[model samples]
Structure formats: structure tokens, C-alpha cells
Target: MTAAQFRTVQQPLDPTAAVGEIALFDAGGNPLDLSGGGQKITSVKATALAAGTAPTATLANGVLTIGIPAGAKGAPGTAGVGVKSISLTKDTDGNITGGTVTKTDNSTTAITVTTA
Candidate 1:
């Protein structure tokens, strides 16, 4: 091909409008197809790595896999102090008379509810 045969060109591609399709090429400069018979992602897999390990990703034979380090279970969660359960005292008519909020550390707080 002569230099005169090659000229710079620019065109807007509207992917959503099905205006154009991307061209694919192989390592040897051979053109590839993007149809069902062409190379495509066939599988995906993820694995959790060690706590101190770094995250990584890889693609091979149409398979894409990712490896992410499992976060350190977060210091055993610091023994949550949030409410564990709420025991309510109800009347015969199913009215809430009073209640107690029990926390995760076995601490309790009495709750007085007024109904109209």
C-alpha cells in the first residue's frame, strides 16, 4: 500500500444505534469475527485470597476470573453493643404495656410505651 493510499479519517460511532461494530484482530495481525463463532467470554470465576493477599484478575480461553483478598474478618467485629432483642409486655387486648431492649452485651434497658 502506498502512503497516498492511506489517509487519515474520522467518524462518529453510534453503538446504541447499531451504527458500527468493533473490529478484532489476532496476535498475527489476522482479522477476527465478533459473532457467535468468534472468541467470547465463556465463563467467569471468583476466589477469595488470603487476608494479606492482593486482588487480581485474569482472562484465559474465554474465561475471566478474579481473585480478591478476603478482608480480615474485621478484628472479630468488636463485640457489637447493638440491641439483640426486644421483650415486650402486652395486655389481654394485645396492647403493648412496656418493653425491655436487651443489648448484645447482656445489658438491658426498660422501655415504657404509651398508646392512645
Candidate 2:
């Protein structure tokens, strides 16, 4: 096509109320993405954990609070190599009564705990 067959003009587009949809196009007449803040949004995925009692979930003022399971109480990790013996004394009912934990380090720190 010759130059005369093409025309370039700038026209203001101000649609009034009750008008139809508004479509945006690029230089090549291809439909441009103007969905999410004038940018392209491919997918959106949100996951929410299941609800519970002791460990409940709360959301307030765009903030989320999730409760995690509490750690084991009155228990130490595996005794290190320098530990001589990690003894735990219990009664006949299997209830933990008391214990004496000893570690064979240079300082030899000994700890004793009694619940009964």
C-alpha cells in the first residue's frame, strides 16, 4: 500500500457512563494486556492450612498468625560423645520422678532435677 492508503491520527477516547468495554491495542494492532495494574497476570494460587484447636490460625489487619506445635518438654537432645551417662529415674508407674545428667567434659558439669 502507498503512503496515501495509510492514515495516522490521534483521537481522544472518553467513554461516558453505560458505555461498553474498553479495549487496548499495541502498535501492531494486537490486544495488549491491561488487566493487573497495566501488567500481565498469568496465574494466582493461594493456599490456607486446615483449622485446629490448640494450634489455631488468625488473620487480622492483613496479618496472619499460625500456631506451631510446642516442643518436647523436660527432655534433652541425644547425649554428646563426651557425655558419660544421661540417667533418668522414674517410679513404678513409669512417671518420671527425677534424674541426674552427667557430662564428662573438662569442667564436668553435672545437673540434677527432681519432680517428685
Among the numbered candidates, top lDDT falls to: 1
Cand. 1 TM to true fold = 0.36
- lDDT (0 to 1) per candidate: 0.62, 0.44
Write the residue-wise lDDT of candidate 1 on 1-116 in tens digits: 00011111357877779563333344454554436674465765777889987555554677645666787775555555898999999999998899999998899999999867
Q: What are the TM-scores, per candidate, against the unseen true structure?
A: 0.36, 0.21
Compare the candidates by TM-score and give the number of the best one.
1
Candidate no. 2 TM-score: 0.21
Candidate 1: which stretches are off by over 4 Å?
1-40, 78-116
Error of 2 at 47 (Å): 49
